[model samples]
Target: MSAELRDRFFALSTGGAPADEVARYLAEVDAVDTEPAATLDGLGISWHPTVRFKAVRFVDAERIDADVRELFARPSQEAPYLAAVFVDPRELSFRTFENIVPLDRLLADTPLDLDLTRRAELAEGAYSFSLRLPAAARGHLERLDALNLYVPPLNSGSRGGERFIFHSAQLAEALTKAVAKALPQPLRDGFSHVNPVFRCNRFEPGDANFHRHRDTPYYDAERHHVSRYTLLLYLTGGSATPALDLTGGVALAEIEPFTCVIFDQRYEHEGAPYDDGRKVFLRTELIFTFTESEVTHDPEIGALFGKACYWTGESVFAPELARHADAYYNQVAAAHWSALTPGADREPFVHKQFRGVHFVANGYDFWFAKSDKLSLAECAAITLLDYFNCKLGDTSFRALCQSEVIEADEADAAAWIPGFLQDKRGDSAVPPIDKSLLFPEPEEANNECCPFHSWAAFDATRSEDVIELYTQAQTFAKAHILPAPIVMLGEDVLLDPDKFVIRGNSIHVLGKESLTPVNFAACWNAGGLPGNYIDIAATVDTAHFLVPPIFFTESDDCYHLRFDFFRNSWMVKHQQVTIPVPMVQDGVCDDGDPYPWRYAVDEVSLFTDNASDRGKADLWWVDNPAVEDEMRDVFD
Candidate 1:
């Protein structure tokens, strides 16, 4: 009610007034009280008369949850915070919201302790009170305005939440002490003083006022550190409605000069908008974290650490790695620059642009049994190949042709595969494959079938000797080089054998429904070593697969398999004949850009101009689509 209207009511009821007039005044007062409070334009009072008494009434219930009752009984206990109430139950009260600190008192040089005590009294008595900020803190904000030291809101582009922000050590210390006094001793002990920031949020016409927000939970994975509590203090603002409202509970509309609100950080609340009016307020947060050393010692947490870091002790020394990584990143960034192509859209396959060697060591599995000398190079080749296939979908090898080189060294390799991968500086000097080789013209010749196909010369039924499947497969592969699907029937039907056998087998190709006998030379098993080590076959399915090759020489390890692309090792060997891995697109043949060789071939020419550097004749292939038909004819 306005003061003018209240004065008229009192005047009429006082001294010698008619009984009817006094009764009318009382009736009007009752009516106004029962009706909703009047609000100014663009401003409102959110009141929930029931919220303040909720805690008390809940506790008073006979059938209240035991855990909730216990939590209300002692809210300051450490760990396992109660979920029913976000704030400390002790701070909640059922009382009228009023400003304990007036603007005049805040302008005065009042001691912070006296103000803090006054604020606490209001809290204990009325349940909600807005006390004045410490005189020194208020003066500090004035000094900031005078010196023009405030910076624009850091997150202005998003929610222009702050007008300006300035840091003050003196203000932080005083506020921290004031907040510490409110919290119970148990909570105070766990609190670590983080540097506080003083920010003035402005609510003006068309400005984005504060929205509902919660502080981010501070987490430290290594130490298992996490935030426990928070404190927020509201200093000053212009609008009458620009006050803190713990929605459904308390609203400190008429705040005194240094009015502060302290609550648990997890509380869901928002700053009331000033509407068309302008308002400025200072806010500081006191963040606390719990450092429970026991988390590190717990068996499950310890196991997680081992699993997360891949059992490498290197994770323990982060500072050492950070120092080197930072310097190295800077050096690499300085050496490379990207060309800007305006209006050009990025390729779908372009993961991202990097200045230099961008390394990402995601999750990895490093459990492998060591055999023989335990060749590190072989491990690198195997790991990279596995990563290429599993993570990048095997097409990454083709995608690498356009991507910036990412140099990965042993130090940068994932912790799981430590000391296994190292940067081979000379590998960069090797030329990349020519693009023309990938997109050969129609005149290019495809791989021809072996002229003297001699696999039929061998009589399998007559031979009862046991021999290595790998050796026999290699012989058959070299002899019968056809694009059609070739099947080598081993001693067992499924190809699972610990020892070799002379069992008769059968072979079949697509369209030929009946299985042909193995003695008819219908089978060719040159597909390295199958997992079963039994019936090995390399069918013309057009699907690319990588199999562990049995190396004859120690020198033919991972490095040779990966980087020594000049040689035709069994791991990256291209087949002699070509076949269409039929891909039906809209029920028609979709040859898929006719360059499986870009992925299948080990070496690619990096020469931009086709005529400048003719590649080795032996290494090049003329991809002919007609060969697929010829192979199909042979199969049929």
Candidate 2:
């Protein structure tokens, strides 16, 4: 009797019969055989021999509690039972049928223009589209108690599909009741909801083939719920050529239409290729949430899990960094709390906190130091607290946490104040200090180059000076220095400065004018600020600075500013009068070397072929005319 029913069902499914006809035949098979697994075996539907199987007809949600209990009663090494088939397609109503069938038709009719150049980059020949189900369809699925079986809408696209997420209270209750018994002791009572999102796939038989892969767990946008299991439902089935192949040599041939397979996402599986027919499936996930106690095993420690807040620049860091910071803080907090427990695992906690400190320190050093938006002292304090908490042993850490006072010498701030300022002034040529060195690491006690000891010694003798220098250094680093200005004569012609010399009041800039642009053309000069002169001098002498303006006649465009060597003034446009050199000069240093002077030019006018456009041949100015007054004041 089972063999006859199976043959009739297969013929109806593969012979282009309506889905309702195949569904009606399966309902008839369900009427004769009460056992789902026995019916499947009798009908020749194969599954993994080692995998445990249980089936619940979609219409019989009331009986799920008893069935789930019976399935989990047997001893199983796997945390969750392998697979559960939601059988009997009779529950797929006409409304659900209308929502699904038209999507396949739309996908077929839509014209897809595949980029031939990117053929290798495409995912096989199957195209994917992100779509949402119609409001009416969602309402009908809810009314039919078929929310779990809802299919998303289909549209035309090139590759990769989008996830559709929707909430259904009825589906959540059914899933919770079904998997409640199988959850671990801690997670049994914490059942949250079935993942509302559906991962839909449409595979055309000669074009679509999925390689052997394991699905990763899904986390919701907020990360409050995570999926441990994958729910796969086949809406249409044809062609036995491509079987559902599992890791254990189990190949399910001709999986009946509307058969929903629930399995662990960790299971490795693939779809074999077929020469004919198409397969469409919708994949959803079962999501669960863990409370603070369940996650950290302690209520007090769990309180800190999601509470730590860190500052991050939206433009500077990746968007995911904020989420990662929350997770890392929770992990580190849990480890720290666990270490404080009596007779708890100490080494692992210490190691975790140590690594976490480095992460926090590096993040601040590389990113936050440049912006100076986050407080470095606060970051250092947080890291120091973690270090002391983990390495100081349970008793001492506990005492410190309870606010017990520890004796320590207080250094006099006045002692190192003068010397620190003098050292900073003397060492103005030193390179920029790495801000991360301010973070102390006591673990590397034996390493001579470790910054912890150096920092500690500085703290004792010159802490105030270090703080002052750090503030100034951070400010200095944030200043924006402009690049050398470009002088363009018409579109393609460029005035490239080869050499610049200042004598008295006139500044002479000598360079070649090229019709074709040169790779490097800017006139660079040795420049530095008083505070950072030493550091700047250590590398290249040239610094980015503004050039002074040069006024020239159309007939004498080649004549540039001439610097008077004796009078320290500038002669402009061959004028006999000398303009006092506009330069800010610092007095001679202790070593007798004069500090670099700074000046700027407002505009450098040149006669160009198209200078007549502005109605003046000699009035053509450089790119930036806004600084003309400032440049003129240098000579004034």
Model 1 agreement with the true structure over 523-604: per-residue lDDT tens digits: 1122211111222222221212222222211122122111211111111222112111111111111233222221221111
lDDT of 1: 0.30
lDDT scores in order: 0.30, 0.30
Candidate 2 lDDT by residue in tens digits, 135-160: 54334332222222222222111122
As a TM-score, model 1 comes out at 0.30
Model 2: residues with Cα > 4 Å off, grouped in runs: 1-192, 218-226, 240-243, 272-275, 289-636
In model 1, which regions exceed 4 Å deviation? 1-114, 120-137, 145-147, 150-154, 163-165, 184-194, 217-227, 238-254, 287-350, 355-636
Count clashes in each candidate, considering only residues at least 3 apart in sequence or on different chains. 15, 16
